[model samples]
Target: MKLLLTSAGIMNKSIHDTLVDMLDKPIGESSALCIPTAMYGHPWVGPGVQAWEFIKGDARNPMVNLGWKSVGVLELTALPSINKDRWVSLVQETDVLLVAGGDPLYLCYWMQQSGLADLLPSLRSVYVGMSAGSMVMAPHIGEYFVGWNPPNDSDETLNLVDFAMFPHVDHEMLPHNTMAHAEKWAADIQGPAYAIDDETAIKVIDGAVEVISEGNWKLFSS
Candidate 1:
């Protein structure tokens, strides 16, 4: 699968160009399925509201400027109550999967329940994971410790990728995600860890992994 996992979506022209190249088609002919289910876990709160607004806006200029013709949201939580086959079809037809950041476990639950996990390996779409969305692709979620909620009881994640990703590290806007926190989080993990800021990301195409950054990031081994 082709994945462009970011702390924040499309931070610069270089990343945008890379994504467009990965798509291998004019963005105008493509469709992006934006998943906002992760943000729902934090309803009414400041961070939640911010994520919800991101979904509502769909990173308007970032996506529009890239030339994606159809950018729409597909709430995975609501799929079980509807026609899943059609939903799956839509997922398959999408050229990109724009996943927003929030609760990693909550996002993983819906993904497994909706059967997206099973289908992800074969998906032709470019997977763009923002923050928690990127975290869910790891073997497990680490000490994300953002808003001081109860720790995720289950550490298991989708395991689509091999390493734990610590996103928003040293992020200017999110003072809560400090380099110190990232260091502590990685120290406790058992495998390779990546601390990525908003301007950086971890991109995996097929079996190859590379840090795609316009700003800064660090990879740690345990």
Candidate 2:
């Protein structure tokens, strides 16, 4: 499996350029699966609306500059009820699985509840995880204490890959407490932990892990 784990949305031109260059695929050929149910303050609503417009060709969307030809955005607001027939079909047909930014604990819970967490790893598609999407790929979801509610119970994660990732490390653009919250959680987890700063990514292709861009990353093991 090819995994593109990003810290956040392509927040600017340089990052977007890097993504386009790395994937080497047209925007129309790829599909983004937006999981917003985990986000608080209605995070998914804005992106969902914009993604729909971007793919469907409406000027009002934020992603219009991407110029992707065919984009399918699904609003997975809750587990069990979220994964409808349409989302299932999209997952099966899409060339890429783009997991968007949201609350990590919420995303993990919904992912397991919806059964997609198990199914995603098996699909022969490129997996793109942004923000919380990247965090859940880890063995534990506790590292995402910032901008997310803490997890109450220990649950099995996707385990598609071996290492746990912390995206947007030192993301000063966000609220001041984001990194502090994440740092506290990071100190508690035991395993191979990765702290990735914004505008950076880790590309794992066939079990080979490599830093893909300009940023800082740290590996922690206990």
Candidate 3:
């Protein structure tokens, strides 16, 4: 599987180039499915549309800037109520799957219920995960306290990758995401953890992991 897990999506030219290189195909010829289900975790935060617009402005444009022919938002939660077969077909057709950030636990719940997690491993598309999206790929996600409830023992994530990921590290705008908070979170993790800022990405191809960053990031181990 090919994955580009980022703290805040593609943040620079080099990161865009890396994604393009991985695509192999000309960017204009491909399509992308941008899942924003995670943002729904806190629907009451400001206007829901504002968060959607923000994700689009910050994250979606990068894909378009790189030349993806068409990129559309597909909320995984709406799948079960609609014609899921069509959604599955869309997933199959997309060249890349971009999962946006919000709450990891919220995203995991829908992923599990929608059966998206089960199908992710077999997909040929490149997976570009932002924040919460990146975290769900780990064996376990803990020390994650957002507006929603905390993850309990029964809240198993899709263990797509081995290590847990903590995004938005030391970001001034994010009050809860400070270096001190990350240190405490990492210390409590049962396995390895990675703390990354907006301009960083953790790329995983097959089984090899590479950190690509234009900002700061660090690895924490028990």
Listing every candidate in turn, what is its Cα RMSD in Å to the true structure after a full C-alpha superposition?
2.7, 4.6, 2.5
Winner on lDDT (2 vs 3): 3
Question: How high is the lDDT of residue 108 in model 2?
Answer: 74
Error of 3 at 182 (Å): 1.1
Judge candidate 3 at residue 186 and give its lDDT: 84
Kindly provide the TM-score of model 2 when superposed on the true structure, using C-alpha atoms.
0.73
Alpha carbon lDDT of each predicted model: 0.78, 0.61, 0.79
Model 1: residue 218 alpha-carbon error in angstroms: 0.3
Model 2, span 79-189: residue lDDT tens:
476536656767766666666556666677767667777777667666767677777777775534534443655634567677777677776655543545556656777
User: Candidates ranked by lDDT, best first?
Assistant: 3, 1, 2
Deviation of model 3 at 63, angstroms: 4.5
Model 2: which residue pairs collide?
A: 28-69
Local lDDT at 132 for model 2: 70
Residue 30 displacement in candidate 3 (angstroms)? 1.7
